[model samples]
Target chain A: MDSIDKKLLNIMQKDFPLSSTPYKDLGEMLGISEEDVINRLGKYKKEGLIRKIGGIFNPRSLGYKSTLVALEVKEGKLEDTASFINRYQEVTHNYQRDHTFNLWFTLIAPSRERIKEIIDSVERLPGVRKCMNLPSVKMFKIGAYFSLDEEGEREEQKSDQ
Target chain B: MISDRDKKIIKHLQEDLPLDSRPFKNIAEKVGMEERELLKRIEEMKEEGMLRRLGAVVHHYQAGFAYNAMGCWRVPQEMIDEAGKKMSCYREVSHVYQRPSHPPHWPYNLFTMIHGHSREDCEGIAESMAEETGISEYTLIYSLREFKKTSMKYF
Candidate 1:
């Protein structure tokens, strides 16, 4: 990503403008045309650099309970266990990690009681030896944002300028 | 806490905004409101803390932050706030949270997602965090595969 692109990513991710012509506002800040900003964002989306451009709601404010869960599964049941855990809509993120208690995922539900119920059901699944539900009591940072200033990255095919 | 109009705007915002120069114009048309009123409503939602922001969600993998690891720390109960506050200051550390850890099986109370351009970079930050916090009991679990990732569509 170029310097300008970095600046765009930085501002766009943190706080985008709320206006009738939002891209025009972004263009004004970046010293570009409205069409240019839109086109660049479109290209970034196509390249998977920009995942999505939209509103991010506060789940806690919307009455949702979320927690990070870790599971120690038998070696042979890794795939089966992970897939079984994935079937639940509440399970948003699931991953295999390099640890003894390998399988981990994040579960979000409408209520804390539902989260506990889901965890209880997960504990009953065969090959699941243990379940650790780490619910967030305090939040320091909400999401990930990479600074654009960093240079010298492996050149992937560039998105349209 | 949201009205029907708020719900309608959310449904539009959750999906991709219309790919046009004046995206709000299309949203206004779909939501049955004036373009100017649509903009004002969005501003109000943000002020009311319903909508966080209108922006691009970068895929770290595609954005050169290829290496990412979760640092679950086992800080003492009393030191939880201090460690969490300190770790949150680090730029690499994202999404720091205080969670209850069941001992004898899991002993991590504070968790942070750390990202880097490389695995070594991630590990280095994790080590520095451990040293800074003075809590050696922790695990840096790097994500091996992304089974699913998406924003919640509550609207």
Candidate 2:
């Protein structure tokens, strides 16, 4: 990631223009041709450096409820238990942390009732000793970005209101 | 209540945007809308707060940020705001949320996700945060494995 790439990221993070030629819009600001901007971004995508370049919807506004759950699974069965939970499409992010509650996952569903149903089923999964539902009481920040500037400080994106 | 047209537009836009000068041209065609109309609708959605910023989400591992530290702290209810503000002011800290804390088994109420290039860097940030916030009871839980990470499809 060089300066030009960082500059492109900064622009993309702010607000991608809705236009027939969005890359051209980005190129104009950087004093480069549209083809160059597209080529750089395409390279980034191919290298797996850029995951997705699109709109991030607000889950709550879209009528979805989410919660974070931690699971204490048997030592030997962690992988299997994780795989079992991963089968649920509602579970978006699942990770293993070094703690008694080794398994951490976030589940989003259309309603609180549906989320409850998922938790109910997840609790019954084999090797799961205990399940703690830790729903977000407050969300302080939402958007996450890494700044590629020389100062090593990340750009401060506006927090979710 | 998202319209069918809106859903179709979102499904296409959420994926990797076409790397073309006229990328939205194809999306507009696929969504059965004029290019200008599609652009106008997306702008309207942003104004309506239905969408956040349109951005690039880099794979952190490829970007040299392999350390993903989740700092879970057992801050008192009243201190949540203070702790959150203090920790989140740091650029390395990404997400900060107030979650329910079950006693004994789970005493961490405030959770913050910190990204770094190495374990030491993340731990150092967590340490500094704990020291600054005066929340001594905290653990920086690093993600050992990521089994499933994907966005929801409301359609």
Highest DockQ among the candidates is held by which one?
2
DockQ of predictions, in order shown: 0.58, 0.71
* Deviation from native of the Cα of residue B42 in model 2, angstroms: 1.6
Query: How well does candidate 2 score on lDDT at residue B99?
Result: 90
Model 2, CA-based lDDT? 0.83
Model 2 chain B is weakest, by summed lDDT over 10 consecutive residues, at B52-61
Alpha carbon lDDT at B117, candidate 1: 71
**Number of the predicted model whose TM-score against the real structure is largest:** 2
Task: Please give, for residues B1-155, the per-residue lDDT of candidate 1 as tens digits.
Answer: 66788789888987877657788889889999999999888888778777766778788787777888888888888898889888877877767888888987777888888877788988898899989989898888887767667777774
Clashes of each: 0, 0
**Against the hidden reference, what TM-scores do the models get?**
0.89, 0.92
Model 1 chain B: which ten-residue window has the lowest total lDDT? B146-155
lDDT per residue (tens digit) for residues B45-84 in model 2: 7788777666787677776677878889999988999998
lDDT of 2 by residue, A27-62 (tens): 898899999998888888888888878778877877
